[model samples]
Target: MQRRRLLQSAALALCPAACEKKRRSPLPFATLADLTSMIQAEQTTPLLLVEHFLERIAQIDRSGPRVNSILELNPEAKTIATTCKPGLLHGLPVLIKDNIETADAMQTTAGSLALRGHKPKRDAALVTRLREAGAVILGKTNLSEWANIRSPNSTSGWSARGGLTRNPHRLTHSASGSSSGSAAAVAAGLAPAAIGTETNGSIVSPASACGIVGFKPTVGLINGAGIIPITHHQDTAGPLTLTVRDAELLMQVLAENFTATPLPDILIGARLGVLRTQSGKHPQVLALFEATLQKLRDAGTIIVDLVELPNAREAGALAWKALLIELRADLNAYLEQRGGDVRSLAELIAFNEQHRDTEMPHFGQEFFAQAEQLGTPEIIAAGQEARKLAMQLAGPEGIDAALKAHDLDALICPTNDPVGLIDLKSGDTNERVASTPAAVAGYPHLTVPMGFVDGLPVGFSFIGTANDDAHILALGHHFEQLTQARRAPAFSAG
Candidate 1:
């Protein structure tokens, strides 16, 4: 009660979330891998480069600077960064979401105050891959508290411990979440590239709002051995990057599932499904999508008119239901077996009760309490039906059905409506259509910077079925290779 009361006092300033577009944080227009080259060419050392980023954080993050995406910096970064070796992206700096673990100094809390001091014993599989590939782990960025599982109606990017991350594009605008800080960090040049995982819009939504490239590969493409739990059925890590090439570069180095292969000029004879229903997005976003589509058509790409999936809505509904059930079951397993300093979900609720002073300051623990009681057979049985319904509706029934009908190699849609204004008292307006279907179905989805709206960026997405991942990536790469629409934001005074 004490924690809640104190937190509620400042809730207006950072209530359900902080106000968006706080300031115009224009970014240095650049690519991620290019920074690696500049570092290697003796133009800068990894230490100096990392320091420059740290300086940027000092200037704009939520603390002194108040951009507010980063939770903690790795103290050993400067010491470890000086030792760069041979690899595709040797010495590139990476910012990871707090949910992903690293055997480093920083604590992985998924931005929840519950485990603020808890530390993982070792690196998650992807982190290990990044280290092996010669990339430096910069630090952990914030997320929608607990990857946005705390509540169905929870605000994006509002964590009690980390606060809310603002978008670099327009400060008062929503940066999107659960990968909020990761995307904002990339857009703000706090780090060259960052890893963001998604069950639904966790990765892609933020990447879209931050006006960067976000990629969610086919499930199982990347191993998930040591990350925080969500729906195991659809969760996967991806790149929220500045360019398609940069996103792809990160993927090549990270995915142990593949041996690195040089990509040729991707084929132009691809058939793409233009999701007309997705056109009702913000006019500015639609304008950019049309331009990109016209460019692809002019370049000899086959554009197909694909109708809406008959069961897409049902699939979306089921995906949300399954996530709630899986979150309870998966989080319980992780919290119980992980043997961390933090207690179980039920205990967490009690801790929040005991320390409601800090935990429930901004929002209540309704979801946590619900999860605890949901272990009953009624909830389990209902959850199972939802899961089954989702698989049939989203999978072979919907997207696949459309793909087969159109002979589509990929489907193109606006990543989301332009980033909305960040509001504190109320949570997100939550109006945006995402590529979440692809995410929920465990398919491959890629968002490339298509154009800017209000001087801020939004991306165009390409989604494809599992095993057909290569085709979609190729299509995205081809468009990205041609239309380089991405530009870093300019840090403007509010």
Candidate 2:
């Protein structure tokens, strides 16, 4: 009751006019379309909207539930909201994952204490595009430390600088990562949408767990420059949003080729290969997936069952080897270009060792240490081989092969298991994840809320071949329309 009173008082103080308006929105789960419509109806100003969100962050993130999703807020957010011009996004507030650079007062730490005070001189390429489209850069959200590349036994969403970001659905559960904060913030209504980068399960896993829309565009659809790196081959940023329509709008702004052909009536008679190998273990998740497939069948969709990604397991393993080699080269290059004190992978490992109390409280940098052991010659040769084999096995021989062999338009599977219990001592306990094939193939993967598992949300994934982002997104949008399965989090107790 005291927390509720505090939140009400803060809202009244910070947004008096909006709070007094009889018909004003009370929840923070506004989508891009909802905000644009509110603006069109003269119901809200961008600055007022920004204040509402900031106040919500203060009330919920810092006060009540303490989601801890946001790390550093943009001090200039109000000024940006006041000055932003009308465009695709108008005045939508966007929270970026902390790894993405912004040439502002906020630091890009990638949730690590070692890079705590480091600031990049320029915004990441996607950040620049988003600003150009008239979105206010609200702030940076917490993420899995170093984008979850520091340790093999690291907990997802637990960071030295930002602490642990909790699941909004039910506190004390994992939000999954390395895009944990982005998903959590969007789910909790702290932000309408957020930018999340993924290498493997990062984006889709979190979005699924948080019960929102996560779209990982085909690698190279959006430029990855200026973002902290895990691997250049697989790292790409996309949006985590309340709805698929919002995802499409954000993708249009981010993708280099924005010409998305009008979505054909893809649902009716569309052949979708069910990735039988990766549908996750949780019975509730499986039940929800089965129900979702039934919906597709009722809508005239043809299900291609028993579809398997050839050599998928082997390819996933090879992809990890590729990431280690790429991480050393890619991350060092980024660190050097940013001109930070920790300019190399070796120095970063040393700094973490020196700051053991804070940086290694829960996990050590075994991944970093392994990455540092490789010389450039071995890194390059191994990276080339791993990338080559993984791409072939996951792409043409994996997703593409299944699609062609079954005459399918796309592939579908469970995005991940339900949100796991947060266990810092044992680290993240996700046992069933279905993002590897798309991640390794450099393909577009879209995960939309499918249904719930014991009141916790789960999602279904749509995977398409490279540059088939529009098609998969269309499929997801249609699925979202048919199911309308996403529900706002209940903010359940620990």
Candidate 3:
């Protein structure tokens, strides 16, 4: 027995390299760039990548940790992979947020039961762009119902159709919203990356909470034709990825009038301003911010402290008012064109009331009801004016003014507070987040994992003026390289 045990131990010791060949290809937490390289080098085929991810979705997303990030997987993904030609994305499998329409076997319900089985006749412009770039549509991810516009008191990751998407880092924590599933899936290594939309903090907040990179580009930069609407002024889809470089690559494929610009190789002498007002009230987050600032300083960055945006409070309030007013009109338009039985905001409200047991069990649709009440033509005109003023305040007088005044390239702040507890009774308890100014202004916002606090992740943000997507991405890439702070989630049962 002793001789047999010794022989077995020796065999196990020699099996690492041999056994590794039989293990999963591409490894866990592989970035999109890494996958692209593997595909280009013929190290892995597209079908293999799809199969591997499908298996992971079964193991990690569905069963093991039960992150429940995906709403539906593409039944045709493997076949699509086998036929996909070499291009920018080149057989990569990418997940789409449910709000974005894809004309496929999978449904795009935006997490609302009313829109169940609602598949579009044509792909959303961004989905078309992904297809053109040789990406296989892997699946649709769950989201906050109606992109969290259904209720002012809604729990962010909970949907009547998809249930709740838990944070991969800690099961008890909130995944933020409405891009919760997209962010969680990327952080959990279910896919190389996922696409998410942001009306306010939908992309960045969830990305920060899940410890990944989320980039919200200028609103109109990517075509917004087929996405379910909140407000056209504030709504845009962006990439959530494990690295800023992957975000950049996805943006290159998604953006219209694509232009490639050379980015700086290093962060030395890079000038940045700190947005103190939007920085959260969490002490630990603030400490992490300070430590990150010192790291930047040590890396030869010029940090300008405490730059305040003018009329930030007023801008946010006006933006909210505008969103409420626009919601009814924009959503009505989308619903009508979408050719669904629930074809209007009023009808949608009624649909929810009829299905209250499923849809309204946890929270009421106060925002939708409020928006339905404000359907007067006069209110819509007022909303347009408010949108104009908000853009001026948050864009020219806000982010741009601060940058020009300080002669800085961009603004930096904490992306969000640490992950809050998942509370269905009280709904989301998110504190101050740095996504507002950029979100309202339709500028570029990039969040990269900064560090952890008490086993939860926080992100450092880079906010820049309109059409400054490339510069913001470059800045975030530099910070990511310098700090290397992003760690894969352990799926702890906290």
Candidate 4:
């Protein structure tokens, strides 16, 4: 087994006195294990943790940087934490994305104004499972309205209910999306960890841009019964935290049967496919990626370089078509059960039009209009075919094919370019993102902090086949141990 290496860097060691104190405090930016140990040793109670987080949310999130990551907090969080039964996550606080149902005093608006007062009669299955695991539902984080499916040119992290979520690294940069708030909140030390759902790049991208750990488990590994839909084919909630082990703990709780055994030597003799095609255009990103490649080589891992996925553009088009159709059908189903003020996609569109002053001030609902028009049987059939083709292309013909051909245990690529400038006037400025293949294939993808560029952080992704969630987590954990790539956000405020 390869011995662990510590990254003894000046930046890491030169933490401010306040940060050092925070790191040692009752509610530090800590790992799940650290918190659990404190609780187990009777050093702190779950109620104390909840109150600490709630106070931090009030100080940093609502007043200081005005990160705007949270939409609402559960008033009964302390009560729930106090009376919770012991389980894996006992007494932990996890922030749920605004898109997920909580069935509490909070509303599951999915960041849409139309669902401002919508409340489900029952909690989402995942929420119920989390509660059973002793997790205190901390509150809801803001997100891109309708999970950023409302328009092609919409700004990420900008929901009508929750204005804009600023990156803690730099107040003006984008937090990515549609899991924007979840990632931002975690990065800003507003929560120990948060749950973020992804359809394509939603989870990993934000986690990547925000400089944290994001794990998108094999689709269907975690129950998606309560999450607001983007595409049932690609939606799954995962954890965003300071460390990969925290993500593993969360995955265990979320995927009830999950238990991770340490891989004695995760890197020795392992073969990893380097998806060069998906690396971003940014020069700094390329440099960081190359440095990462060198680290892997030094660790005795074989790198199969310059690999490409076939039919990339065509598969993307198909995925888009499928998303529209699935959004229409899946959303309608969710609304039927949700019994919201707006019952259908058509009503949602009309509502946006009616509230153009607030909702449409930034971008129009073009994607929603398309979804409204995509209800015909012919369109539905075409969408199903497209989804199948996209899945085949992204799965067997794409990621799976290359993995088999190269004898790779996992795949690596830049998760996204460095954080972009948040521009509401022209909408989100996206860069090269490596999420589509695993997303459409319904596989597991994990993004870990890689390095920084121009003071902003970027991440590298480790992707594996459908049931390889544990393997990916092990790889990420090993890599993190070797590099210690994650840097605490500066919380640069306006």
Candidate 1 lDDT, tens digit per residue, 409-494? 77778888776677766678886756767876788888877788776667788888775655666677778878878776754333
Better of 3 and 4 by lDDT: 3
Q: How accurate locally, in lDDT, is each candidate?
A: 0.77, 0.88, 0.90, 0.87
lDDT of 3 by residue, 188-288 (tens): 99999999999999999999999999999999999999999999999999999999999999999999965656667557898999988888678999999
Which residue pairs come into collision in candidate 3? none
lDDT by residue (tens digit), candidate 2, 366-447: 9999988775796779878988999999999988988898888999999888877899998988657788899999999999
Ranked by TM-score, top first: 3, 2, 4, 1
Cα RMSDs of all predictions? Answer: 9.9, 4.6, 6.1, 7.6
TM-score of each: 0.89, 0.95, 0.95, 0.94
Cα lDDT of model 4 by residue, 170-189, tens digit: 88899999999999999988
Reference-based lDDT, residue 174, model 3: 90
Error of 1 at 111 (Å): 0.7
Tell me the RMSD of model 1 versus the true structure: 9.9
Itemize residue pairs with steric clashes in candidate 4. Answer: none
lDDT of 4 at 456: 87
CA error at residue 103 for candidate 3, angstroms: 0.6
* Worst 10 contiguous positions by lDDT, candidate 4: 1-10
